[model samples]
Target: MTNKHSERRVVVIGGGIVGASIAWRIAARGQRVTLIDKGEPGSGASSHSFAWINAGAKEPIGYHNLNRRSLEMWPRFATALGEDVGLRWGGKVSWETDPVAAEQLQARVQQLQSWGYPSRQVSAQELAELEPALEIGPVVAAEYSENEGQVEPQMVVDACIRRMSELESLILTGAEVIDFDRDADGGIRAVQTDSGDFEADTVVLAAGTDTTTLAAMSNVYIPQAESPGVVIRTTPLPPLLHNVPVVYAPPLGDGRREIHLRQCADGRFMIGEGDQESLAEDDTQSHADDLLSRAAQYLPGLAEAKAIPVPVGWRPMPLDGYPTLGYTTETPNLYIALTHSGVTLAPVISQLAALEICEDVRADAVLTPYRPERFATLTEEQVAEMAHPRAGHR
Candidate 1:
């Protein structure tokens, strides 16, 4: 399809992985693209992300399908960017020890299997064979999905930005978007940033947590929940297991927390807790210690691993706990891209968003469920009703 706005100027706000991907893709299509960020690119949520590239545990079949499609596109996407973003597709291993949680895990695995997803329950022996380093304490059930993976999110963003520079796309840092300049017809004509105003035919708000604030400048309301999360990075250690991501949800009691751990390409292990207990405004030491202690139970190697917590960051989750993509009705030229799994969805979302913007085609068929208009008239009760069970501060 030929883009009607092939020669138009595009300004992408937010230099994280998603914005960098969009800017690079648009520039590749022969458009004049500019990328602006309030600080260094990928220093926000993208830097501190768990960076697990997976579709294994996503709920609502449609969301899972979207993630699966993105996982399929990641390899080519990484290759095109021409750098190692620490992309590893060793898959994932997860288990539950409690009977109730084990039953839930079985049902979830069955549901995934019914959806044609390559996920299956594994026996204790199979689990051992998959990850020898893990000490499965009374594992009632376990599963392994060969389709999951992980990435170094900061590396991906840096690679995309480097390619964007090679493409001669303008990149501005420390330029905070303050407002939008609109024409009489209510179409965006330019973006007003703290640095200055830049003219553009289209403006994309890919800023993670700041998306809502920017949308309001164009008279658009994008409701987002405040979900803060932290990731603890340990010093580089010997290879743990076979380079696979491991998720363990032990029996819930005595402050035991769900653990997510994966070794980066550089040999450093990234660990995160799934709990949402709030911490002191400036204190993450206690939380980091809790996470390391919990992980040490399963992997004794982590017992003495020094815990270095990454910067605290918040996920840009919509009210319904799903991605919000596509343009707005009030401002036709203003586009939005927000989600919790930014690392997993960056490539595909960027491709689809670029198509919609350049070709003047609506991707409603594929993105209908995640359109931003759903929250236009969304009521308080409706938001409460749509709250996801797993949706928490993180």
Candidate 2:
């Protein structure tokens, strides 16, 4: 393995939010760093996401805690980047459209409260008072978290790339890393790219869905769950939904999907995840109208949201529907950071993982329980046996 004590040269594959953030953090610590992207930085799944920095959205107290840590780091990260990534901390409102969903929402509120995050239920009257324009359904209940927020995904990538370059880190665009070569001792030496051979003391694969292919190059199989969802941006409207806004409708239980409606700072309200389909691969974009049609069903107010611009992307879904984050057991220097919540946790993970790489520490201890390698360790039989342990696992 390359000596951590020696001056290090690190190459990060995939220049999305995670990769760029990692490169920025590593270079900020005075290390030699290079970030390579096949296309433009953050133009991939990073920029295509909902762009919400929601700490309380995660289920299970552990996920919430991880998000809380990320939440604490976000302010410092935004200030350090010193650019307006359209970040807003106006809080979020999550709602349900079924009595059962209301019960579940009540339970989730209790869970969030137990974790010391302030989330409380709001009545239909309170909900109406909060947003007079919102047309609540017959079975609507809401839980509001005051600290949640959103950001423009593209702006975040732009700021991080500029900051990484300013920190003197090599930012390589349009460089696709096709393969990686590891020496006899299991150390990554050179990454074979379309351009040429690029060498580094360490390699971190934050390649989003492509991480699976890169790990396969290293003979490691990482389980991936891909979900294709739609996001529609409406024409800029008046500040209809105030603060960090979100609306949720319960699953009809007919194998359809639930809804998470969000309004962005740019006067665009994005409706997504109403017709969740389990994605087979991350090879193609999804059909936008399928999701948009579903959104129109949940939100009667959406009929008036004009000129909706639709975009579709895949969120890396682990088998458990939670994020799989950590380094591989077979390769010490080969690190993996795959999560749908990358936007929310980009700054935190970058800061923590950079500390681990630069300081010779394993910050993976924090997220070790959720390691991608967990799937690697399980036999095919085991995975088949334990599939879908939790309802609405996402």
Candidate 3:
């Protein structure tokens, strides 16, 4: 990538991890960038993120490879940020108590191994030795995904913002986007924000839940499913899991979901049940306490920890359960980036998005499956129904 786009102005809406990463990447590549956020950066869905960077759970060979590519780029990406973004790589471990679930786990591991991922079924002894802190209940079967890991989303966002500042990019917080100014051909000419107006050659809407509404202003349709998740935190405790960075303990009984636990760099444990994009709406103190107590069934050390209930955070879920990326047909210069695994996919997504915006090249090879135009045919009633549980649109 050269400085050919040095004269092009890039305006990024949304200051979450995705937007921040794209802003910094665009700015660093010599394009003039303006980052606009309605509130403090990284204070939205990112704050409530589990921050577990992984690819094992992703499906479909292409999408899995996309996440795996970004996962591999994390270390170098963190290095480029010039700060420790609390990236830790010890892999993810999970076990099952039920025989049926154990069979499912075995098959999952086999499929991952066939994909060349470093995932394999581990014995009960190996699982115990891997994380001696965990009190293995009745492990009928278990597996370890060695390539998966976790990171600090806020630290990653801050690092990107710092790099953008060093590149002389402008950042506006608490600046809601009121509207957009269109050019003769109907491309975004400028962004009208409460903070002020910012002219742009390219406008990237990476806003979390608001991406749909913002894109609709330009006649671009992007539908999203309601994804409310809760990942409660515990009061900062001493370093808990020594070897594995993440643990997926089996449910206590028949009617429970699998609980995931990971100790942050600050020693606070983030406990959440279900997959990264699973819909969990409970954020009450009782739910938080129950989550912690269930985690304690595996990691006895957490028995004394107090659960801190966080508000239910709505994840940015494209209707099809994949990323909505690249330029739209209605607005060629308007880029749409909305995804469920933004934290894990940030590195590769930002780099490719910057390439498309800066060099005037399309990343169709990797991003063709996630174009915003895919959602162009939805009916008015469908659009109305899919917009629920969304945060304020900019």
Candidate 4:
């Protein structure tokens, strides 16, 4: 079959990074694409994303390899979009304070090295040298991966959507997809939105946390767990750390926190803490204060940094904590793209999803493990049990 995806009326639901990327790719292939979103592009999870682009701590060989491949594709993707999406390949450094956790961290690093990943252990002195602004704490062990990267996720989404528009793809903001109009043979004929119904040859559901709800409307079951996360952005500050991102796993205690901090191209630091235990009861300012307090331990400059109004978005994690990609067996014309690392996986997933939809080819070899059919027979209770106990963060 030819690679041309010409004239196919492809309607993409969701205007976040993933959806924007997919719509852009499809439109690039000469497909008639329409992107629908409840809000402006990137204002959903894309806006609140940590935006770290790395496969450093990803588990399982398959998942890690997938991320690695996508990481490699990012630069080329950005270049194609021809926009400054704040894409940076400055690498990443991570460390653990507890001895037990340090051992575990080192072991994981070694395993990644064995898998051909560029990850290596570093001493506290080396870490300090790499990040001069960091106030090195008690680190049992640390690892540095030069291949890691980060991006301004919202900027990337905007770039993709802008390119999609240039390619003649229709973009609908503040238009929500309410349901799907199915043909007699059970294929999606058109997408019913709050604004109006739009006919499409194929419908792709890239809605972040709402993916499960949309899939249910199509008589398909794509189980996703509730994984709420908070990211606090500080007002523009003088450069605090080196270009690279830093992940600190403090000693495990009742009140100890895991903190990740990285600076954007504009000099603003995006700092966030893991686990919801530190979240305030009713005040987001208190949560931001806690994040800043934790961040100051590593970068002393953040002690005086002011917190900005950042949106807290829930991550769309599949029940088994992996991406649920590919189309449903029953609804052949309906494709699903749901995952937590939308920032990291956007480029590759968009390319692959576009190819499958436009060429009508099966990507089973590359996406078999993540297909939605894996959960096709599960009951609602069984699906709920698949969710992680922690149930939050990426």
Q: Best lDDT goes to which candidate?
A: 3
lDDT of each: 0.82, 0.72, 0.89, 0.82
Q: On a 0 to 1 TM-score scale, where does candidate 3 land against the true structure?
A: 0.95
Candidate 4 regions exceeding 4 Å error are 1-5, 249-254, 275-283, 309-311, 379-381, 390-394
Q: In candidate 4, how many Å is residue 270 off?
A: 1.3
Tens-place lDDT per residue, model 4, 284-358, is 887787777777877888887887646667777787877788889989888999987888999889989988887
Candidate 2: give the clashing pairs: 225-317
Ten contiguous residues with the weakest lDDT in model 4: 274-283
Instruction: For candidate 2, give the lDDT of residue 378.
Output: 84
Q: What is the C-alpha RMSD of each candidate to the true structure, in Å?
A: 2.6, 3.9, 3.2, 2.6
- TM-score of every model versus the real structure: 0.93, 0.86, 0.95, 0.93
Better of 1 and 3 by TM-score: 3
Residue 113 shift from truth in candidate 4, angstroms? 1.0
Tens digits of lDDT, candidate 2, 163-219: 878867888889899988789977788988998888888888888878878888887
Encode model 3's per-residue lDDT on 151-180: one tens digit a residue: 999999999999999888898999999899
Using TM-score as the measure, the top candidate is 3
Per-residue lDDT for 1-394 in model 1, tens only?
Answer: 2255667899999998888888888888778899999999998888877788878767688888898899999999999989898888868878887788889889989988999988899998988888888877778888888888888888888898898888788999999988888999889899998899999999889998899888988888888876667778888888775746655546446665567788877878877765322221222777777777888888888876788866677777786778889889999888998887888999889999988887788888889988889899888787776564345322
The deviation in Å at residue 58 for candidate 1 is 1.5
Error of 1 at 123 (Å): 1.2
